[model samples]
Each structure stands twice: as C-alpha cells, then as structure tokens.
Target: MNRSQYLCLTALAAAIGFASAHAADTTVSADVTAKINTRTMQKTTQFDRFIITYRNGTTERSSATAATQNVTAAVSRAKLHASANATAGSALGVTWKRKLAIGSDLVRTSRKLDRNEALTLMQQIATDPAVAAVEPDVMLHAVKDYVAPASASPGGSAPNDTNFPLQWHMRPGNGTVEKVGRDTTSFANWGGSGASSAWPNYDGSGVTVAVIDTGVIIHGDLNEDYAGAGYDMINDSFVSGRAADGRSPGGWDLGDWTNTEPYITECLDGNASAGEASSWHGSHVFGNIAAVNNNGTGVDGIATHAKVIPIRALGHCGGYTSDIADSITWASGGHVDGIPDNPNPAQVISMSLGGDGTCLASDVSGTAIAGAMARGATVVVAAGNDSEDASSHTPASCPGVVAVASVGITGKRAFYSNYGSTVTVAAPGGGIYANDASSGTQVDAGFVWSTVSSSTTTPDQGTSVTGGMAGTSQATPHVSGIVALMIEAVNEAGHATLTPDQIRLALVNSARNFPNTPDHPIGAGIVDANAAISAAINYNSVAPSIALTSGVAAIASGKAGDAILYRIDVPTGATNLTLRTLGGTGDVSLFAKRGNPPSNDGGNADFKSVKPGNSESIVQTTVSPGSWYVLVVGVKDFANVQVLANYTAH
Candidate 1:
C-alpha cells in the first residue's frame, strides 16, 4: 500500500538503456519473448547478467571454459546487443563470471541490455544443442513490508519478556485500544496458527531449519548452532557489505543498509526515495521460527526447541538468484563447489525471499528446490509482499515448495500479501491498520513484533524488539517452525521423518478453512499447527470405508489440496470394478490400490487417472475380493462433485 511495499516491483529497477541491432536480431520466438517480458514485469529495462543451465554430461556443464566459449559464439551469431546506454562489445563485453552450484554458468556483460536485446541473446544461447535453459540472473530479496524511514522508529530495547503480549501472530487475541495502545480495531475471534497450543505438547526437538535470508546475526532471543549454522553465500563483496571478498563461514549480518552512493543510485528504479533502513531482516525471520522459548527474555518462537542454520543469501541491494540457489542446495545437504559441505543439513529450508516471474522448470533456483525436496527437506517460501498473484513470483510458484500467504489478525489476507492458487497456506503477517485500509496509518502494536536491531546502518551493539515489521516474510517462518515441530514430533517418536511431498500434503490437509472468503484463492486456509501435527502423526492411518455396488456410492464435496481417502471391499468372484470421479467443475486426481493406498504422484500408483477436470477414472479389469483403497486429492476446489465406484460381476 505504501511506497515501501512496492519496493520489490517498482523500486528494484535501476537506470535503463537501449541497444542497436538489426531488426532481424531483435527477438527470439514469440513464446520465449513473452516469458522473458513476464519475468522482467516490464519494470526492469536493463539486463546484463544471465544464468545458463547446460544439460548434464554436456561439454558446457563439465567445463567452464567450454561454457564461456559457447556464450561468446552465441553473441556473435545473434548480433549481440546491449541496452540504449550500453554498446561496448560484440555483446557488451560479454564475460563469464562463475559456474553456479547447480552446474549452471553465470555470465555478465560489460553493461545492461534492454529486455528484447537480452531475450535475443538468450535465444541465441538456447540454440546450442547442449544448452538446457538460460535467462536473466534475477535478483531476489527479503519480503518484509517496507516502512518509510521517518515512520520506522526503533521500539523498546527491552531484553526481557515484555513484548510477548503484542505477538498476535503467534496465538489468539483480539486487538483493542485498551490492550494495545492506539489500535482501534476489534475482531472478537483472532484465531491464530495454533502454534502456542502445541508448545506444551511439542517443542520441535532434534530438527534443524535453514533460515535463508540476510543472515541471522548475534541476538539474545535466537539460538544458533556453531556447526553448520549456515553460511554467507553472497558472491559479490559489494552486495554483501562485508570487508572480506569471498563468502566466509559465518552467516552473520554485517549490515545491508543500502542508502549509500552505488546502492542508492543503482536501486533507483521507480522509487525516488529508495533509502531503506537495515532491517536485521534475517534475525527477525529467525526469531519467528526458532528463537529460544521460556528464556525469560523477548518472544517465543513457533518451534521453540528447533535450531536454526541461517544461510545468508541477500544483503545490501537484495541478492542474486544464483547465490540463493547455492544456499538452498548447501542447506539441504546438496553439493555446492567452493563451499564446504554443511555438517548439519536442515529438515526444512525457510526462505522469506523471492523476485518477479513464475518459475520455469529449468530455473536454477527451481532446480535447487527440486533437489532439496528429493533430499527430504521441506522447503517453505513467502508468496511475496507485492499484492499481485503469487503465480508471478518465483519459489512460490516453483513446484515442491509450501508457498505461504499472509493473513491479518482478523484472519483476512494482508493488504500486501500476494495471492493465487500457488500459495500452499496462509499465516498471520499482520495488518498495521484495518483490512479495508489500503495503506496503514499509525499503529505500532499492529505489526508482527520480533527481534530486530536498533541501528539503521550497522549493528546496534545489542538486540531490540520492534513491533514495526510485517509481510509474507513474517508469515513464512511461522509455517517453517511448525514444520520443524511436525518433523520433531514424528522423529522423536523413533519414526522416520516424513517425505517432503507427504509433509506438504499433510500441511494442506490439516489446515483450518478460512473464516472469510479470500479475494483470490490461497491454499486451504490459515495454517493450524495443532491440526497439522495431528495430521502428520495420522498420515498413514486407516482410510474410511465406502461400499462399491453395495451402499453409499459417492462422495460429493472437496477442496483443493484435500487428499481424502476411502476404501471399498469387493466380493468373491468379482470380475472388475470401475472407480471414477465426475460431475464437478474443478480439477481432481484419483488413485486406487487393492491392499495399500496408491500414491497420487501421477506415477507409483497401482492404478491412477488424471485428466483435466473432475472426470477421472481407474478401471481394474481383473479384480480380487478385498479392501481396495482410493485416494482422491483435489487439484482444484470442487462443489458437487461425485466420486463413485461401479462394478461388473459376471
């Protein structure tokens, strides 16, 4: 609503320019052009860097020298061009920077290139038989609400448990002027994520979560392990704000205050006043997830007993996608060259950062995410602070991530939350004013209060608690901490940790429905920690029974992300049984098996059917008499859909 929230969209673009090229060299294919434009959001006109993924076993993937040679050849072949302000080479002095951890090459031009020119060059690169994909090396930043410097005053520097009363995002409590001074809003039922309810029950023991952001600094409220506590993965020394050049071991925030010359001058896209205060953003996010509880100081984290491995991905002027990808890969126990192996890999990777554009399958970040998921680490990301469809954001739209949206204390979508079907669930991200207010006026307690720094430019000597921050950044860690609890609850009981897919489904299935209809669809509803923990514990529980050609033949209702299970008993001499779902205007996936429930992974199931709409069928020609389990997961919301099983006995 304010100028700060638009920082991700309008403020990130810097000075623009154009290029001179033949009309024939102006574009790639139409489809590719459209995607490139979408990623840029037309907000950014300058592009000088690119991330190129080459197929495995290819020469480019194996040899960095070979990769650079390929890009140079592409520039020459495509009549390489730069932005209006840049024209310094065969292609703006195209130079290969480094190879990414995911086996992708990071190439930089001498200067910026306009969108079309960048697209034309990328198209040329893709034309290589070994090239898998290539695109701009996009920048992703922390997603906290942008507060104007004048309004962002440091709150009480109290190092005790005083500010816990104002943490409405953690538990249920109506906001009133009497309780929180100068806040004129009341919602009798302020149903929060049930995190506190599960506190006395589960404390997320023996689980490590990777907090990938600006890096968690020294704080009294936060507990970080010495070994594998994460790293400073930022590649550029200028963006990192660290005196040393190479990424070091400590994932500490040396301060990313971007009001200086190069930072201010470069960050001037649409934002005239782009002087942002150093947030200590990573520490804030870390506090929300796993800050020590009952420590007689500050606030309580959702997963009180969980440990955080803060992976520093963003600093100064946001961060590069390649750095974030490397952090993700290393955090989840994957390999990243030039960086030591993480001794303590996390069970969940909490990312409160992202940038414009939906994730392409070949995106380096998306590929890293898939790798993390394959390692059984649950990845959670913020939907974004830009109040647009989350489908337009990275990580959020990426497959295998539990994308979270923001809800206010009243259980409505936050004014700045990005929404859409991509969001996996919602959590309290705080609204400084009433939900109807486009932009918040003035209310300190209405924000998501947590551990923050007092100094605007550098470390404030010690920590402070400020009730002056809110966004999908706050919402994401709540879910991550809960996931930690879920993992702990299951693992502490001597059970193997749930797979990332199963964990995602359990979170989706256990969510309590939204109290009010959202303007756009946002997963199941506000996340319920109590319900989700129970759901994880009972994930493999026996399925409810239904009769095939005997009694109740149909189930008529479902919501997206709901994987409802039922079983049917066939009789002796049974010839065949046909199970199908129809009469619905929403997407649904059907899976069935005789003895065990089938996985709805599109494969790995005994028999499955996944078409477009609710019309899906699984026909077993040769059937045996037994309890046959069926799993019906809503790919989209369904109203009066009927899931029925028919049989042929001869």
Candidate 2:
C-alpha cells in the first residue's frame, strides 16, 4: 500500500508492556502465524508494506521477474482490491519492490487494508506451494527510553571532552546509581561499560563498526570513515518521507521527525504535536561506538580509534525488517542486489532497533544474521525497551546476536530494559527515574552522554553538542564498540582473527559481575571493556597452558560465569591424555576442544566436564595429539581453581 501508519507493539501502547516471558518463537506454522497476526493486527487496521519469502528452488524464487509474476497471480486469486475500490481484478495494487539479502521479497500495495482483509489476503498468498512465509512489515523503532534530561544537572570534569563528567556511564562505578545533589566525583565512576579503562590499553584501532540504524550525520565528534560503506537503505519514499524513491550513497539522516503530513498521522497518533523529535538516533549510537577523542568538541566514543560505517535502515515511522535484514547482510560483506559492495566491511554490526516478534533461526532476519556471522561479523542489537523478556523481540531473539539489556549507572537493570535469558550482556542505557524507581521523579544525570545535532527534525551537523539519550538503543553500541576493542586486541597480539563464537565467549568470560543482582536476568553481567580486551587476547593465543602440567595446579580464580582460557600444545601421538578441573572451592566446568576454544554456551565444546561441582574431568575420550584448548568456566563463585592434564605419549 502507498500509505502506512506506525503502530506500537501490544506492550508499547500502554508504555509498560507486560508480555509473557514464555511467548513462543515465531514460526510459519498456521497456529503461530495466526497468533502473531492477531496480536499485530490489534495495533492498526491500515497497511501497505510487507515482506514475503519463497522457498529456494521454487519457481517464484527463480528470478525477480518470476517471483513478482507469481505473487501477482496469487494476489489476483485473493481478489484483493485497491482501498475504497470495489473492482475485484484490482489485485490489491501490489508491486514488487526488490529482493532482500535473505531472498525475501519486499512488496507494497496501492492502498491500506484492514486486519481481516490483509489476513485473508495473506492466507490466500500462503496457499501457493511456492510461498514459504508472508507477514506485515511491521515498523521497528529506536529502542531508547526518551525522557528528556532534567535541566538541573551540573557539568563534568577533566579529559577535556567538555562533558566528560556527564559520562559516568563510561567509567567504572562503585556499584551504585548516584542520586541527585551528590558531588560529581562521588558518582563519577558509577558502574558502567568500563570504556574509559579499556581505552587506555586498547583503542579499537583498525576495526570498523557498522551503526545500522537512522544512518549517520558526520558531526564534529564523529568521523565518517575515509572508506566507509555508509548507504541509505530506505527504498520507500513514504517511509523515508524524502524525495528520493530508491536507495542512495550517503546514509545521512534527513531528519526522521514524525511531525510532517503523512508521518504525523501515520507514525504518530494523528496529533501533530505528539510526534517525536528527529532522534539523531543513528548519530548518537555511532558516537557511542566511535566518536573522536581528545578533540575537545563533544563526547568521547568507546572505540575512539575505530572507523564507522553508517547504514541507514530506519527512517520516519521506523523501518521494515526486510530492509534491516538486507543492511545486516551488506554491512558484513554479504551480497545485496543493486547496492554497491561495502568498501569497509564492518567487524561488528550494531543495531539499536527492533520490533516485537519472535525470530526463529530460519527466518529472514535470523538467516541474515547467520550470514553475517559466517562472514566473521558479530551482530549486536538492542534488547528492546518494553521491560519484558527480550525473547519476544526480533533481532534480539535471533540466534548468535549480542542482545544488550540496559542498566543505569548504578548497574541495576533499567526500568525500561528488556531482560531474560535472551540478553547477551547489559550496558549503560541511561535510567530516567531516581534510583530506577519507575514512579519516582526522573533525574538529569542518568543519560548516556553522546554527540547529536541541535536540530530536532533533521541534519544540522555543524551545531552539535554532547547530547544524551537512553534505552537499550544507547546500551547496544557499548557492547559493539567493546567488541571492536576485543578484535583490535587480538590483532595487536598478532593472533588470528577471532570468530564470532570466540568474541562472544570473551565477552561472557570477561563481564563484570553485577554489583547488586538484578530482579531479572540481564546478562552474564555488564560488559567490562578492559577485561574483554584481555580475555580476547588470551583466548586467541596459541601459547601453552601456563599452569596445567602433568600435576594439578591452580588455573585461575573467578566468580560465577567467568571463563579462564588456556591452551596446550599436545605433541604428536599423545594418547589417553585427560584434562580436568581437579581443585576449586566453587563450581566450575571444563570445556576442551582441538584448535578452537569452547564457551559455556555448549555449542563448540568437543569435550566437556559438566558434573554438579568443580571436579570435572574428560576421561571418556582418549585425546589425540594436537593443539588442545581448554577453558574453565565458573558455575558458581569459585576460587583456587586448579587444572590437571594427565597424558602419555605413544
């Protein structure tokens, strides 16, 4: 359809979405699709955008022309008509836009359709044996909790970024969210992502991070990489609210303010004044990842030495999953028809946008992530702001993505952050409330400081300042930048490039323990940038195991969820060699594998010792002589952990 309205997910309507943590993953099964349709349709009755996929090897998937023709025939069979038109042969005025990176088709219609009408139409389309899946291209917004910073804040201290003191979220904290009226220094180091500490040792040099959101506006503090692969992905003029009908070169933000004619009514609730300000969302997220340092302009980014590639995927009333998926593929050096290949392929893909929906591994966006991972790019996404379990959202729920949950300076879960087992880590997405009390008054100091333009509706790049915004949207880039640092650390150490799995494990093992345990599971813990860099360097090393000789020796001491990595070069023909965690005060598990390091996630472990306590050993399988990697993961708060490797050379 030509016109579309932005509809908040079932939870965002009331501001506090209490979706069940047990929501099942999205599937093409009739029952689940029906459930998803029913829930989605309740938000709006109008539509125009949709994403349809045909199974590979089908006639529809044969060529773009063939796919379009078959879909046209299917819609004609559905007898869909243009809005307010009674002609049956109108066939809903459907037009195929283009093919997405995951082989899905982006299609639009001539007019909006009500829920029942669209459902019936989709059912008819799905009846085609070639059709694999079809769903409304629901809007995905920036996942920030936007409560304006209370104007009563004082200024910052040294580091000369002008607003460094306001950036408490970047430094290490004393395990508390300092309330208002306290001296700035008293809470200057509140628990945060530890970017400041990490920067001293690792600067994310030679790494590139893709900010795949509202695109970017090169600001005073932000560097548009000399060879950046930034591009605008918004193909729908209606969605973009711009004059351009198709994609373009620069991924600059032409203002996504929803106050204009169509967006005022479509994205916002008709009230023009209720429309949101142009969030400069992508710029802020980018700044969080790689804004320049020592420039004395605005805020300091996490990875100061890293270059950024801005990939515009969301605009106006948010964007479609199909477009976002294509962005993931493109940013990671995967193929996307028509668009130029990325000159600076991202080492990490950071997305702070998501819509509420289950994303199965086989789904469009899920497969796109898999493709990016295969190309050695780590995907990091916001866990959403609905305060519900992150499992209910796309991208975040997708397998292998680093789903980040928001935690305020105190290191407690932000009231608006999505949590649960789906979260990969927690970071500084500013908290709006006093001490994170949802009902209490909001404070000014809680915002995660970053760079932004002065304009509320578009690009005013020259007039930039240290602006602040909150949400997992802001928290996401923290981890993305840290991943860049980790990658750089490995490179600096002259080791092989880290696989996505290795990077993930390094984050998990190096995460700082939550100061005060959260009410819900946020992640392994807040990411510790310094620790992550160290962990990554250690995990990638091929050096021999330092303490694991023929006899038992202390391996490492750590708390629950900590992973200490070690490597042993098994001489040729060594057999019956056993690696085990023999002595530890608390519970720890052993995971050993050949060549690759295994993580606690249990996906890459060739041999595992997963008994109740710390006395875990791999005795069942005879070891072959090769370079063996070993990891000791804390099952509980453990200390005095010791490792023993008993083997005989044949």
Candidate 3:
C-alpha cells in the first residue's frame, strides 16, 4: 500500500478517543508503556507530533523535519511515516503483530512478545542517533464493535437508483403552505444578496426522511400533515412490532429513546423523567425539516412539503452504540439479516445530536454510517454542541457523512458550535445562553421555531409547556429540509439525478462563504437552500474537464490557495467550470476571468481550505468562445500546492 494509505489503516485502530469519563482508558497498560519508553519515538510535540508503540518492542515516531519544505506539511508526513515504520518494524520483529490505536497513534506489536523484550527494543530505538524521544503509548476507551445478528432471510435485491432524493421532497403533497415565523435569519444571508428563488416548485413531495433522536410526541403539525409512518430502531423491532397500532410512536416518550422497553419511573430526574427527558426534541427537529408552511399557524419550515420517517435513538444518560448502529442501517433499508425492512425507507438521514468523542472510519458506528451511504443515503449530522474543534463527536466525524456546524441569526457562529475544516457548512444553530447583544445574539430561541409535540398535555406539558428549542440539534434539520427541497427541484428540473458527491458539490459551490468569520467556524459559509435548490434545478449536466499542465508547478496536498494553470477553449457566456481530483483529500478550487485564455491575462483564483469532495466549480464571468488558460489551485491554512493542472470549457 502507498504511504498515506498505510498511515490511514494504521490510524484506524486508534479511531476513537475518550468516550466518557467513566469508560476504560486502555486494554494493556504496563507492557504497552514499557515498550513505548524503550523504543525512542519523537519527544516533542513540535518535532514528533505522533508516536506508535507495539507489543513486540517496536516504536515509531513521525519525522516532522524530513517531509516537504513546509514545516507543518513535514510534521504530517512524519506522523504518517511513524505509523508506517512502526507497523513494518513490528511485522519484522515478531511472529504475530497486532495493531492498536491510542488516540491518534496506531501502534503495532507481537501479541506473544514479552514485556522485557519490548523494553529492551524500546531502549535501543531511543538511543539510536535517528531517534528523538519516546513516551508511553496511552490507551483510549471506546465502543467495541458489535457483531450483527445473522439475517433471518437471504440477501434481497440491491437498490437500482444510485442517487436517492433527500426525503423532504415528499412534503408538498401533504397539503400545507410554508410557515414563515418571526425569525428569518437562516434563509436570509445564505447567498450574497439573500436566499435563492428556487422554493416555488417541487417542494419536497414524495420523499421520505429519517430522523434518529429522542422520541417525538404526536402533534397537530405532524399528524395533521407531513408525517409518514416510522420505525423504532431502539426497540429492535418494526414499528408494527413495537406499537399497538404497529406504528412507531409519534410523540413524547416518558421512556428512554435508547431502550425499547416501557417507561420506568425510577431514579431519573424525578417523576417527570423516565430515563432522559422525552421532551419534544425530535418532534421539533422533524417539523423544521418538513413542517407544512403557510399552514396558517405556528412557524414556517424549511421544506413545508415533505414526509418524515422518525427513528428514536437517545435516552438514559446516552444511548448504546449497538442500537444506534442498527437504527442507522435499518433506516436506510439495509439488510441486517434478521430485521424486517423499515416500512418507510429514508433517502436522507439527519442526526442532530452527538457526543464528545473521536471515532474512526472503521468503528461500528462509522461502519453503519458508511453502509447507509453505500445504499445511497445522504447522512447529515451536527458536529456537536461542544465548542471544541477536533474534539467534535462522531457519526458527524464519520468519513461518508456531511458534518454540519452551527451559525446564528446575525450570520456569525454559535458559541456552543464546534468548528473544524472537516465540517462542511454552518447553519443557524443559535448562540450560547442568554446574556446580551454584546455576547452575540441569543439565537437559541429564534433558531428553533418549528412544530413541537403535544404529548405533554398537562400545564407543564404540550406546546404550552414543551415548546420548540434550539442547538446544533435544531440547525441540522434546516439543512436537512433544504436538502429535501433541492432534491425535489432537481427532479422537477429534469436534470440527471445527482449522486451524493454531486449533491455535496451543489451545496458547497452554492454556499455563502463567510469571509469575516473564522475559517474553522463557518466552514464554506452558510448552506443556501434557495441557491442549492436552484442549482439542482438548473444543474450543469456536462462532465467536468481535466487537462494536464504543460510545465512543472508546485501542488501542495492540504493548502487551499495554490493554483495550477492550463490552457483551454471557453464557450461563449460560460459562467463557470468545475475542477475535480480522484484521490487525496478531495479538495477543490474556483477561478474566473473575463476573456478567452491567452488573451485574458487578468484572472483570480479562490482557494477552498477543505476538500469539497469529487467535484467543484470555478464560477466565471462572461467570456467569448475562445482559448484560455485556467488554473486550479490547492490551498489550506499554510501553503499553496497544485494537484492537476487542467482546463475545460463549459
């Protein structure tokens, strides 16, 4: 395997970080530490960055100084090298090597190797002239992988369509007008001037969405309109199997959303809490994405025109990994062997809640998420309510899912929102607790203005008692709703069905870049639903052009500002062209100029810090049908590099 790919595999073992304060920290302690100290790994964080220790007395540290000219780039290279070297070294050192991941480091060692031998090897490596310093390879507590129960039935037919529309597309047929409440921050400021004018047609009709969260209580806004029958993944059975009517519970659950059993009025908050507060959290989230707009009551929804397939997952401190994984797979109509297919399959799944943990791409949760995507489902998740960046939680951190951050009404980031380049976009998740205007707008209230559950009928229950709330949890559904709207527009416009990659491109390309905010906070600006829907309807169906450059140029892997130039002909009035890469971090860039190539010397390049996946566009001004030179540059927080230098005419 290539060096990076090798690093990726090694890193997979350490995919998850600390799950909770109560979880186990490591599996093998004394021997692991002894081995790490024996083999010298990099000492300083600046020079070493990452260190890997194996059971068979092998150690590896990233050579931060030996990589590319960029210091940061070198560190990244060193970390990868450390992992690769450690694994290969362990393979050569012992009869059987086992891989272990501690936080971000991947350590490999022989299962049979004794602690004394490990210590000796470590000491030798530490003293070596090439060695820097070494430290104990710590162990991390994470969820163990759960084995799927054997399927009761044989394999069924795989889905035929590769691109399934987001579920909110089915809302229009539900018969309700769009809701326009007091708050208008999310829809506004998405684009340069305002929201796009694309919501009039195909307002999410016939599409089915799955929302996995706290149980939802049946409410007027939902049962009256926009609600489709759903399943209870936590109960480990179909909706019919779990409910008296064979239908998933719609509103408020005194019982935990994680466990399928009945409510136990025990040691919870009080009489009020069964396990966790079964408030209308999920109901509000569902409404925001597909509440009937112009319903003449309550707030407006992003897509007042779609149907939803609700699946509950939260409860009792937190839910179990096994249940969450099963729900994710089942929601996508995946073959779990024993479980019946979800009565209503969802094309789009939105996870508005998350925990503080670092999970790898191979974790059980990650695997399930990937499986759902493989089945052509669009997974959208909140980065987390926690304010830390890399510390952001999983399901969102999973490779295939689109991780969302939170923004507020004023076009700024929410204080409780997590920020990272890995995040895709920022939606209106509201700000921190109420303080004042000096502390930024208290958007938490205004952010979550949508339909709520009516399960609580007492004075403290129902809409009067349990009202809509806000958080990254609430912001996620807005994007989900918009995704549904865009899918509908795409179908109505008669453009070719878009793949997840294409849908992602449309969202990023059309997103509003928040130049004034921190790059980590807002991501590729806010998700412009209106603009996204418009692009979906009028998508550029042609394949992106790829042509290599004639001369040498630097192509940095992570940087977002570097440009690679190539000559190509431009069609008359061509507005933009897309640049794509097959490997690496899936980064992209855009460039624009007025005239034809050789003639048009004045041009500009816009570097996107994070990889926007398979394809992205360089929106250009009007140009004559003639030859031109276009440059696609790679950029990041540090340097500029080139990937492929090619030009294509739209």
Candidate 4:
C-alpha cells in the first residue's frame, strides 16, 4: 500500500480497536508499520531526536535559552552540508527543542523521529563545529506491569490498613502459592530482608532515598514519609507546560492513562498498544520503600522512618533515557542547569525503570549514575522483566550498581524475572501464577502491595488506593528500603557512612541462601534485612575474630558505647576460657556468648565482666569445643582499649 493509504488504514484500525477495548476497560496490542521508503515499510517505533553535547567552556551561561541558541546556530551551520537546494529555515527538518535540565550542554529535538531519520539527522548535527558529541535519545519504560485479574480484590492486613495481608513479599512465607504446584512454606521466612526484625533498632530515620520513576501520588499512607516537592522532568509542553520545560518543581503523577478515543489518536507511530491505564508506578514504588507504618491504616513499609524524594522522569508510554539520567544527577545533589539546588540530597537512589540496552560509560545514564555514586549515594536498579539475561539491560548491567532480580514467595526466581551475572541480589517480587486454578486467572495473593491513588490527574487527587503490583519494579524498593535500614544502623553505630561498594558487599555477603535452586542464578541469594543491618553496623574492623593459643589481642577504639567483636575457639575438653579488657581510661565491659549474637539487647550473656571503672575481666571454667564470642563495649569514649582473649586447648 502507498504511504498515505497505510497511515489512513493504521489510524482506522487503531480507532476501532481502542473503542472496543475502552468500552470493556481492557487492553489490546496491535502491530503498527510505517513506510520509510518504497521498499521499506518498517515497524513504527520511537526514537529520540538528536541530543548534542557541546564542549565545555564553549558557553558562558548554562541556561536553557543560552543552550537553545547555541544548538540552533549549530543546526544552521550543519544545514550548510545539506543538499544545496535545502533552505536555511527547513534544512534536515530539525527544530530546536529545550535544553536538558540535567546536563547543561545537551539539547533535544522538538519532535520524535524514526530511528533512521534520527540517525541521519544526528550525523548532520555532528558536523557542527560546536558539537562535541551527538546521540539519539533512547526511550526507557517503567519496569512494572499491571495485571488485572479476572476477579481482583485488595488483600493484606495491618492493624489499621486492611490490605497488609496481601503483601506477602513483606513478610515471611504464609503458605501462599507463588509458583505452580509449589507452596512457599519452605521459603516462608526467606522473603523480605528480615526488615521487621530490624524495625525496633532502625526505622531508617534521618535518611533520604530518591525514587526516580513516574511521579509519586500523595496517598494517605505516604503522607508522613513524603519529603516535599520533587522535580518533574517530563519536558513535553502538552504533558507538563511550556514554562515547565527542562523541569518544574513537584514530583506529581499526571496520570499516564492512554489509548482512549482522543488519546489513541496521539499514540506514537499510530500504535494503539502503546497506550495503557495509569500505573501510578512511582506511588507504588515509593510506598514499598517508605510507606508510613503503625499508623493504624495501611501496610508497613520496609523503611518506614526514611523519607522519599520522588523525582518524576517517566510518563506516558514510558520516558526518555535523557530525562531519567538528569533525574539521577539532580536527585543525588548534583547540579542541573535550570533547577534550583536540591535542599535534601538523597543518600540512596532507587531506579525501578530500565530500557533494553547495555550501559556504556559514554552514555548519558552512565555518566549520571557515576556522578551519583561519586556523591556517596547507593544506587539500586531493577533487573528487567524480559526473563532474558540481565546483562542485556542497562543500569542493571551497569557497573557499581546493585541490580536486584525478582523472586516469588517460594524463594525461586520469578518466572518473568531476568537473571545472570549482572544480578546483585534477589527479593520477593511476587508471582501469583500458581496453585488455586479457580477461574484460571492468577489471583492477587502473589504480589507486592503498596500505596496508590485512584486519580488519573492531579497529585493526590483521588481517593487513596493501595493494591498489589508485580515486577522487578516492586522488588527494587525492597532492597532500597533495606539499604536505608543498613545506613541507619551504620549511622547509629557512629561509624563512617558506607560507600556504594561497601553497601553492595554487605548486602550480598549477608543474603540468605536460597531454599531451592532457581531456574536462573540470581545474585548472592535473597536479601536478608536483619543480616544486612548487622553487616552494616559491624562494617570495616570491629568484626568478630578468632582467638589463638597465644591469645589473640588487639586495641579497639571508638566512641562511647562502641562494641568490638572477637571470637575464641574452644577445643574438646578445653577448660579455661578467659576474656579481658584493659589499658584504657574509659570504662569497658566484656560479655561472652556462643553462636550469633542476639538480635536485641535484652538477650542474656553467658559471661559478663562489668567493672565500675575502665578495666574488665571474665573467666569461664566450663568451656567446650565450639566457637565463643566476646563483646567489648565501651562505657565511655576511648581511643585505645586493649582487648585480649586466652583459651586452653584440649
């Protein structure tokens, strides 16, 4: 068919399909094709216009207007290379779009173009004298999918919230069906990171985690945890506004619903399937990480005490990678041209969105991520849901990032989860595809439940809606929350904040072994919250040690109440086991115990040396073959506290 005929037919089909699906509140997928040439009617796909980065020191001011003028002039210069008949006004059909808010020099095109056209335009734009580099704007989507069950009901139970019980991913296994014919009983306690166990000690207070995804909604359940107005990076004038381009304050969900009558006509490349109901994705993600707890209303979040800095980068039909990259930089307190300096810099950045490409150091997202890491923010990303090797996805495949894969309540890799060497750990991402085949539709029992909203427009516009969502998108926040808990623990212990590498190591090293082997190998097993907190609190030095026959000795130093850990071996028939603390002006107490230390402080110690002053002594007459732990707690701040242990061999 001719190009005109093809466009007319595609629009007609899309309109009919959308009308039918709209009446039923259902979704339909359709194949769309566009004629690039007489021989090539390629699939109508999305590609960003040329994004050109100018060399540093070329522009005096990094404002949007300044960047726009510079790029416009460059485009004019590039037009000289166009066909001799090309007019200055319409050469290459390129128009100046807004300058990127995150990167000062980068500028985008005014309209989306086909991949080949965008590539050709980029090549022409690269010839400009001022252009340092140019690349196509790659599209990224929210790493979440909303499955509308045949008969769905909000499930979960908390004292105040009625939907806490449905959140099986947040608790130990509850005998739910996570996989076909498999009950999660074997992995009952393997879910979550034992976050509840660490609740009493650290609720993630005084920590900020930036949720970089679709904008968040203001749900009642998230009120206390909401930090403040976050920036919206969707620069489309139609979606946001002309004045809001580059960015505007307030991270609000503007309803991503598409495919309806009027909206279907605006579908990219005339594809109807690209439209979807508003996922409220950012709200769900943030809710999983920092929903208010003990409020007598909703499900508890893993890091209830932590606040979220919601930065909206994804919108209808997903978002552009350039916007997301900027959000990452700005959220981590990096400078972005148009936006004001961030008042609250996030210590952790949680990205539950990704695209289908390997991350390259030269790419915009990679550069932004590196900046965030340099600022000491721990980045957590979702492994794609394509069920392919995670190495094929960006951010997840990026170096120095904690790429989390999804696991069902059964402690196995979720059927839809991507896995491979790129995965850093696994968390419960919910899989309700098994067991009760009542109506043949997967039930809501196998999903992560979190805060949401009913409105398709305005922030916090509709009644609060909390329900279950399944994907690596849901699994990502669990790790982010656990990271918050780890940070809180480390901060409370008066230790230096952990670097991104250290935090990644602690989580991987402390993950619980999987109960059963998974179809794909995911990270170091599922994340263990209690264990992660323990690992963080005892990070670098201060770790439990083994005592030798000559009596392993070392000088422990820290602020007041700091605990130094040591262990001694007791051979079979061994008798004397002596532990002591000496040579310090500050009072230090010694406690001896066996096995792992208790989760709480109330647990009893086998031996205690509580002296009124600086020195402490302990001797155990009855010692047997096994490992024993000695805890040296500083009663007062001490620079050097000598810790010594002696155990007799059998």
Best by TM-score: 1
Model 2 residue 484 distance off true place after TM-score fit, in angstroms:
0.5
Q: Which of 2 and 4 is the better model by TM-score?
A: 2
The clash count for each model shown is 6, 8, 54, 12
Query: TM-score of each candidate?
Result: 0.79, 0.78, 0.54, 0.69
Candidate ranking under TM-score, highest first, comes to 1, 2, 4, 3
lDDT of 3 by residue, 94-123 (tens): 211111111112223323222322333333
Report the lDDT tens digits of candidate 2 across residue range 1-650: 01111123321211111121112212334432422223233355566666678878987785778776775776676566764557644456777888887888878778886654566556556767777777776666667456454243332222457666567777775554443333332343345887887777888889988888888775767776642458888887877767868888877878788877778887776888677667788888988888888876667888888878888888888887677888899999988999788888888999988766656566677789999999999999888887887776777777778889988877778887888766777888877656655546655555777777777776863366566677888899999999999999889899888888678767766778787778887877788888888888897432223435554465578888776777665653467777878675899888875533454444346678789888888863455443466788888998877787777755
lDDT tens digits by residue: candidate 1, 361-459: 456777899888888799999999888888777778776688899887767787778986567788887766655245646454446767777777777
As a whole number from 0 to 100, the lDDT of residue 648 in candidate 1 is 64
Error of 3 at 519 (Å): 7.3
Residue 514 displacement in candidate 2 (angstroms): 0.9
Q: Lowest lDDT 10-mer window, candidate 3? A: 1-10
Q: What local lDDT does model 2 show for residue 86? A: 73
lDDT of 3: 0.44
